[model samples]
Target: MRSEEEVFALLIGFAKSDERIRLVSLEGSRANPAIADDEFKDYDIAFFVTDMESFLSKDDWLDFLGKRLILQKPEDMELYPPQLGNKFSYLMLFEDGIKIDLTLVPISELQSCLKRSDGLLKILLDKDNTVKEEIVATDQHYWMTKPTAQKFTDCCNEFWWVSTYVAKGLARQEFLFAQDHLNQIVRPTLLLMMSWKIGAEKGSSFSLGKNYKFIQHYLAAEEWELLLQTFQGSGYSETWEALFLCQKLFRTISKKVALAYGYDYPNYDERVTPYVQGLHTKCS
Candidate 1:
C-alpha cells in the first residue's frame, strides 16, 4: 500500500506532467481538517481538463496511477445514469487497496463548478491561477441545523409511519420491501434523530459525518452496541428485532431532542410500537 505522501506525490506529479489536465483539487473528507485521519479514506480528486472526452477515449493514461483492481466509469455505463450532469469520473480501486474518485471537468466549466461547490473543496494545483477566490476547506455547510418544532414533528411522524411498511412486509414475507424500508427510510430517520441529539449536546455546530459515520463519538457504548444490532441479520426474525431496536433508539433520541428544544413528542409512538409488535408476533 502506498503512503499518503507517496499517493499525493504520484497524484500531483501526474497532473503536473499532463497539459490536458490544467488544474487539480481535492474534495470530501480528505479535504476536511476536523475528520480524524484514517488510512482507508479515498483520494477524491477533481481535474479541470482541456478535453474530458479525449481522456475518456483512452485506457493507457490511467496506468500511470497504479495497477487498478477494478474501476467504474459511471458516465460510460448504461445501467447507471450520470449524476454529475456535465462532468465525467472514474472510480478506481488500485491493487494496493487505495481508492481514488477522480472527476474530469472541462476547463470551460470552472465558473459553474465554483458555483455548485460544496464547502469542503481544497485546491491542490492551479497552474493557470484561475481560482481567484479563497479555496479554504470547511465543513460549515454540513453542520447540523437545529430543527424547527414542525420539522421535528415531521421527522418523528415519518419514522413511525414508514415503520409500518417494514412490519407489513415482514408479515407478508416480502423481504425486499421490509429491507428497503428498514435501510432506506427507517435507519436514515434514526440517524437524523441521532444527529439532532448529538448537535444539541455538541453546540449544534459539528458534522456527524456523511450518513452519520462519526455518530459513535457522541453515542454511549451501550447505545452504539444497540446501533450495531440494528444492522444484524435480515431474516424475518432478525429483521423484526432490528426494526424494534431502531424504534427504541429513535424514540429515546427524538424524545430527548423534542424535550430539549421544548417541542412536542408525538403520541403515535405508543400506538405504533404495539402494532408492530403484534405484526411480528403474527409473523412468528
Candidate 2:
C-alpha cells in the first residue's frame, strides 16, 4: 500500500493542524528500534488532548485517514469491558491495509503517561514540550530474564502440575476445556521454560518478541516441529498425543534450565504424569 513516510506524514500533519491534539507519541512495534519495519506493523499513536469527549463523539475526522474496514472503540463499549482504565482506544484497520491502535488520554495525564511508559515509545509532536528528557524506544521490558533457583523450581512445578488439568478435561470429553488448558495454561508454561533456556544460551537481555513469536529463530528445526505437534486436533486421542508431547518438551527444556542453575525438579512431575496417564485411560 502506501509508504511508511506517507502514512506518518498524514498522521503528524493531521495532529499538527488540530489545536486540541496537544501531544502525539508512537508505541508498539513501530516505535521499537530492534524491530524491522513492515507494512503489517501498526501505527500505535497516542494523542494527549484537550477535549477527549468531543473527539470520542465523532468518527468524521478518522474518515480522512483511510476507508475504514472495521474498528473497535473499547472504552465506548460495555460488553468487552475496558482494560485501559481511564484511556480510550480506537483499534482501526483501514481499507488499504494500514492498522492504527490510537489511544486518547487527557492532556492532564501526560505526566502519568511519561511515568508509566514501557520505554517502547517515541514522542512525535509536543506542543507545550511536556516531556523534558529524550525518549528512546527499547524492547527491554520483554527481555529474557534469568530466573532465580526458586523461580526455576516454580516454573517446573507449575508446568507438570497444570498439565493434569488437560488430562482431566480430555477424560471428561470436554474438548474446549482441555483446549483452553492446553492453549492458555500449559502452553505459556512451556513458552516460559523455553525462554529460560534461551536466556541461558544467549544473553538474558534480549527479547523473544510478543507471545514468543521469535522463539523458532532460536529453536532447532526438529524441536520447533515437535513443538508445533503439541497443538493437536479436537479429538481425545489427538489431545492426548499433544499432552504427551508437551510433557516431553517441558521435561527436556525445564531439566536443562534447572540443572544449569542447580534447581531441583519438583516431585509433582514424578506423580502427575502417571496420574494423568491413568486418568486418560478412562477416555478410551
Clashes of each: 0, 0
Model 2 Cα lDDT, one tens digit per residue, 236-270:
89999999999999988888888877888777788
Question: Could you give candidate 1's per-residue lDDT for residues 1-284 as a string of tens digits?
Answer: 88989988998999999999889989998999889788899999999999887898887898889899998999889998889887899999999899999999999998888888788888889999999988888898898999999889989999999999999998999998999999999999898988888888787677888878888889989889999999975488899899999999998989899888999999879989899989888877
Top of the candidates by lDDT? 1
Query: RMSD in angstroms, candidate 2?
Result: 1.2
* TM-score, one value per model: 0.94, 0.97
Model 2 alpha-carbon miss at residue 81, Å: 0.9
lDDT agreement of model 1 with the native? 0.90
- The window of 10 residues in a row where model 1 has the poorest summed lDDT is 232-241
